[model samples]
Target chain A: MELIVPILAAAVRSGTPILYATLGEIMTEKSGVLNLGLEGIMLIGAYVGFIVTYNTGSPFWGLVAAFFVGMAVNVVHAFLCISLKANQVICGLAMTMFGTGVSSLLGRGYVGETIAGLQAVALPGLSSFPVVGPVFFSQDVMVYISYLLVFVVWFLMYKTKFGLMIRAVGDSPLSAEAAGISVSAVRYASTLLGGGLVSLGGAYLTVVYSHMWVDLMTAGRGWIAVALVIFAIWNPLRAALGSYLFGGVEALQMRIQAGGTTVPAPLLMMLPYILTIAVLVVISVFKGRGRMLGAPSALGLPFYREERE
Target chain B: MRIKVEKRFYITKWQEVCIILASIVLAFSSGALVFHFLGVDPLEAYKMMIDGSLGDFYGVSETVAKTIPLIMCSLAVALSFTMVVWNIGAEGQFVLGALACTAFVRYLYVDNFVVMLACMGISALLAGGLWGAFAGFLKARWNVNEIITTLMMNYVAILLLQYFVYGSWRDPTSLGFPMTPLFPKSARLHQFFSTRVHSGIFFAVIIALILWIVVRKGVWGYEIRVSGQNPKAADYAGIRSTRNVILVMFLSGAIAGLAGMAEMAGLHRRLQPGFAVGYGYTAIIIAWLARLHPLAIIFVSFLFGALFVGGENLQIAMRLPLSSVQILQGLILFFLLGGEFFRNYRVSFISRKR
Candidate 1:
């Protein structure tokens, strides 16, 4: 009973980064552009976040810089995919390679450098509650932001006129175009904004989770987030559920490892990835034909305004 | 005047060559700019890269050695890519293959030269093929995304390799290094011309030729082409694409595994941490540049192999990181992808429909 609270609390903390990334990918996909470059964007964001915080001594600015720089890098993907109408998958893979290479090169000198990262701040009243408060409210600023972000995203995706347009563009760009929406504009907006949020996920890893820099530190968390996006069925609320579940498994793994279990660390490390595969299987099995129902109809397909059939 | 983008029909071979050349030139120019900012003279860096890879017989041979694994891995990836399976797990498959070969050689000591190599090779192929087939099975049965699954499995495979080499397999006598003891002389592959070059080159060449022939003339090749062109049509034609998916992935993985076995037996003679050098990832780039043609894979892999060796030289001669080569690679991919727009469509300014 006592262990559950800490595990949940740790789960929320661990899940926050993925939640942000999942949310970001949801928005991007909702607008019909699939950017598989989230892994690369996250790496750049982590590097920029770490370096900036180390230099300016302000983690907030570190995040802001990372976000914008991430958007700047995303511009290439946008240009190649949207403007050039190139293969989205290949472009995204290239973006990953580009981001990884650039970040590794730039971050070589800054390796192992520590910074005064974002600290935890518990809300007085909410934090005092037994289980929920500590797990949800009593955490660092990023965790708090992630919570607000979930609702904010849900609202934006479900309620707003812009949300309608984004989903409309994703579902059927031709109809959306006929109904007086600029398909390119909507895609560009979602892609850039979602890209910024994804960058924040990476920034959180450096500015909040760990205080020091390491190469390839994101360690497939970005990829895990990619899986989470699918598991969430593109819903922000479900994304929270999936992220927390993954986080709990991670926390439990660490707890078990800490308690001195006989299982090897490498084998333990495979748990999350294996869990991701298992979850995908379960989702596809249960969801059946509707497994990918929520996916944007125009996903991975380049929208060419001129090619009217 | 509004600009109109029109799809071009029947592009000339000259135009195709020019476009490919332009993409390369643009990529190199961007690479040079990166080198300039990194405080190295871009011109000198280019010269150094070329000379280091191709300057002498030794450099050429070294590049060939690196190219061996690259060719095999490229073919592995290209095979899956032909069916649009996106088997990015070749990295993991490669490491797993190497590990399986090591385990086989270690536990089952066979004195006969060819028999030992054959057993080790078969085990490696099975390990890698099964790893690939697992993803294929998931995709075939559950419609799972192979890209993410394959990519995720790579980390698991690499970690598994690390666990073995760093733990039980660590050599006891050699200053506690995280590698197995040297293989027996029979286990080591035959070298050529008193150099690091080995019979692996023949294996790579043979695989390339065999793949080329099979893809062009074999029954499975026709099925693969049909399925790739139109899955629905292929299905209607009674092509069991599900089986084909698993089969192609297995072969893809098996070839990648063979590359691992060759690297371990021919070059290193023992599994080490250095065995997981991003050849699988680099091979994807080769596959893309070669347009997934089996013969072209060999040529492209050789070029990339040169770039890798040159990167090593740059690391030694100048205090530059090898990641600079990675950056160049990224630029090439970006340019190549961007150039895809040109091949498919052409934009021209026609006076606004008046």
Candidate 2:
């Protein structure tokens, strides 16, 4: 039970960042803009969040700072892809390279520094419940917030007028523009919101999870979140579930390694990556029709308002 | 109140080329400014960069050696990206190809150098092509996003390398380091001169020239460009867009795979973690900066190779941080991308009403 609790605990903690990033990416994709800078944005968030927490000795401030930095990064992406209507993939990749390099250079001094991270905030009576309680209710505020964001995102995407506009723009920007909706505005807002959420995910890792600032500490999690968005078929709730499963695998690998199983550490490290590829392959096999998963029709295409010719 | 927008002019063909060149210069200037901010003399840095890349015959040779893989990978990326097929897993394909080609050279019972080189090249090409084809298949058949699939596969490929180097392929004589056993003398690529330049540079240039020729003259290339420009029109005209997507991806991946073989056979002589470095990732930048033109990729790849070699020299001689090169590269990319805005769209000022 002790081992099981720690494993579950690790799963939740490990999965939170991926959940955050995937949710953010899902929002952007829904608005017909693919933000490839999740890796860069998250790195900036992790570095800035760690620096702020280290200086302030408070994780909350770190989260706030990281969110703002993430928003700033997204705004740049929005300006390029939405406003300027440049190529989305190139812009995103450049953003990643720039973001990673800047963050690493700025974070060179804080390599091994530690900060006081958040602790589990379980409900009073609920904390004493069986496995179910520990697995779900007893967790960090970020994890709860992720759950809330899932429902909120789902509701906003499917229920609200803003959601409708977002969907309309994503499906057909030309038609949306003709219908009097501002495609650029919708795209810009979604991209910013997406960037903010992904940065919070980064903050969760540096301030609430690992509590240290290290160069490229987010490693490949940002990329994995991109994969998860596809695996979940752009559904926020499914994305959260996929992230938890990924976290569970990561948690299991750590446990196996700690138990001194015959498997080598390098091989164990490779397991999650391999699993990600496998899941992608399986998803491809099961994905009968392209539109069934609700992928945006004009995801990566740049919209040109004046190019009628 | 309705706002009257002025008519925007389309950038002329000549202006497009000029803007690209201007952006390149601006990118370099931006790089110099970054150096100035780091307390280094910008002029001295520029001189150092140029001199380091071509100061002596040896330096030129080293640049050539680095340029080989960059050229190959950039060509790979440029070819696929031109067809709207993003093969982000080129890095993984490169690793897997290197691993396969190296294994062939080491364990195979081939005595002839010609046969060994042929085997290695073919294996690398096949491996890379398969990796790309897998992504293309997923994209074409299931409508899965190739970007996510390709990117995820890169990690898996890296892990595969880690597994082999640390596990079954560990060099028995090296005691503890994670790497494969060195290939036999016969399997190694021939060096050109006193410096470490190899035959692989010739191969890269040849491949680039071949791609240029193919795209310029071949029926398939014409179909690809047409389909890429307008898939719906191609579909209406009875061209198989899916087939072109798969074929372009294969060709792209094959070039990157050859890059892996070049690293293993020409330079490294064995597989290691640092075998190819960031050549695959850097190639993405190179391809874009070149605008996915085969001829342009050839030149840009050499430029990047010079930057890499020169950056190392700057680090050793000028006491600048190694990451200075990356910062410079980033600045160039930023401005280059920003410059594209001017090419496609014009910023006009409207007088504000009081």
Candidate 3:
């Protein structure tokens, strides 16, 4: 019981960045554009965020810069996949490569640099509560914002009229166009918004989590976030839960390694990826039976208006 | 006036060349903008890159040595991509191949040079093939997504390699660095006098030639192309796509495994953590850039090898990050992907109809 609070706290802290990425990808996938460049975008965001904060001395400005950088990168993706109607998979992979290369190149100067990170804020009334307070309320401002963003994304995805348009576009762009919805506009906006959120997640890693710059620091977390969207069946609330679940596994691995357990550290590090694959297989096995198979029908397909049946 | 885009039945060769040239120019200009932002002269840096990679005998030899693995891995990707299997686990398979080769050398200890080399080669092929076949089996049996499964397997293979390198395989005399003891002299590949270029290049060419002939002329090749273009049509014609996917994936993994064996035997002569850097990932780009043609892959791989060598030189000469080359590669791929779209569809400026 004594160890549970710290573990849970670490879970939330580590999970927040993934939550941000998963939520962002959820939005993008909901719009029927699978941007596989999340890992690369996050890397660029981390670099830009760290550089901005290092120069400006404010994490706020750093996050703002990251958001713009991510959007700029995704704009290239949208132009290729949307306007030109290129193969989405290959284009997405290219975007990731570009992001990773450009970020690593530009971030060379900032290696090992340190800055003041965002501090955890204690809520006045909630501070007195024991396990729940420390685990949930006593994280950095970004963590609280992530909690809010989860519900915000959920409401935006399921509640709003705009949400309806995104689903319509994803499910059938032709049908949506027939109803006067601009499929291209919705995809562009969603992809950009998703990019912004992913960048914010990257900023959080630099400003709040690591508080320093490193190349390839996101380290495949973006890929895991992509898998998380599938695991959550594209629901934002489930995405939050899934991200924390992965975070819990990551935290447990660190704690065990620190505790001097006999298990090899590399083996422990393989947990999340192995689990992700297992879950993907299970999802595939149970596919087409019910609502559990929640992939967007038109996901990963390029939209074309003139093609005949 | 307005612009109209229409799909073309076939793009002319001259137009294709023009599009490729235009993409190259655009990519270079963007790279130049980046270089300018970083306070370096783009032309000077590019000149240095060329000189560093291909100017001297030493540079040329290094580039050739690098091309061995690139050629093998690119062929691996191209073969599976021919069937649309998406075997992104070549990196993992490569590592496993290296590990398998190392294990045979370290534990089996055959004295005859020819037999030992043969054993290592076969071990690598079998290990890589089996590893690849696992993903193919999953896809065949359960309809799983090969992209994610293969990607996940890459991490597993790397971690498994790390476990051995850091644990029982660590050389006792090396002062605690995470590496295995060097293989015996007989186990090493025969290199040309005073240069790193080894017999692996010969093996690569032979294998590529074999694969090219098989893919172009063999019955299996016909079946694969048929299944890839239209699986339902192939099914109607009595072609079994599931068997083809598994077989193609195994062969693909085997070729990548050979790449791993080549790198281990030719370059390092010992197992190390960072032995195979991003060759497998880069092969994906090379395969696409070469249009999945094995013969074209060889020349493309050499060009990429030069780019990698030049990237390393940039770190020393201009104080630029080695990732500068990666950025250039990425930009080139982006332009190429975009260019493929324009190749299929021609955009023309037409007067607006009133």
Chain B alone: TM-score in each candidate? 0.97, 0.90, 0.96
Put down candidate 3 lDDT per residue, B122-203, tens digits, no spaces. 9999999998988888787677778777878888899999999998898999899999999999899988978999999988
DockQ of each: 0.71, 0.52, 0.64
- How well does each candidate superpose onto the true structure, as a TM-score? 0.97, 0.92, 0.96
Q: Model 3: per-residue lDDT, tens digit, A1-309?
A: 788889999999989999999999999999899888888889988888899999999988998899898888899888888887877777777777888888887888788999887889987788569899988988888998999999999999889999999988888888998999998999999999999899888888899999999998987788888888888889999999999998898888888999998888889889988988887778767773333466778887788777644
Best to worst by lDDT, what's the order? 1, 3, 2
Candidate 2, superposed: residue stretches over 4 Å from native: A1-3, A307-309, B1-13, B28-48, B314-324, B346-354
In terms of DockQ, which candidate is stronger, 1 or 3?
Answer: 1
Candidate number with greatest lDDT: 1
Q: Name the lDDT value of residue A36 in candidate 2.
A: 87
Across B1-354, the per-residue lDDT of candidate 1 in tens digits comes to 987788888788798878888998999999899878866788888888888999999899989999999999999999998888889988999998899989988999789898988998999999999999999988888888888889899989988988888888988986978899998988889989987888988889999999988887898888988888789899999999999999999999999998999999999999888777789888888899898899988888989999998988888887677877888888999999988789989878888654
Clashing pairs in 2: none
- Chain A TM value for model 1: 0.97
For model 1, the stretches where C-alpha displacement exceeds 4 angstroms are A289-291, B38-40, B351-354
Q: Would candidate 1 be rated incorrect, acceptable, medium or high by CAPRI criteria?
A: medium
Q: Candidates 1 and 3: which is better by lDDT?
A: 1
Ranking by TM-score: 1, 3, 2
lDDT of 2 by residue, B1-354 (tens): 334333446768798888788887887887677667656788988798889998888778888889899999999988888777888878988997898897787678388889999999999999988888888887777666788778877877788788888888888988899888888877889987556888898889899899888876788778888887888888998999887788888888888898999889999898888775678888998998888888888788888999888988887888665566766766677667777877766666666776
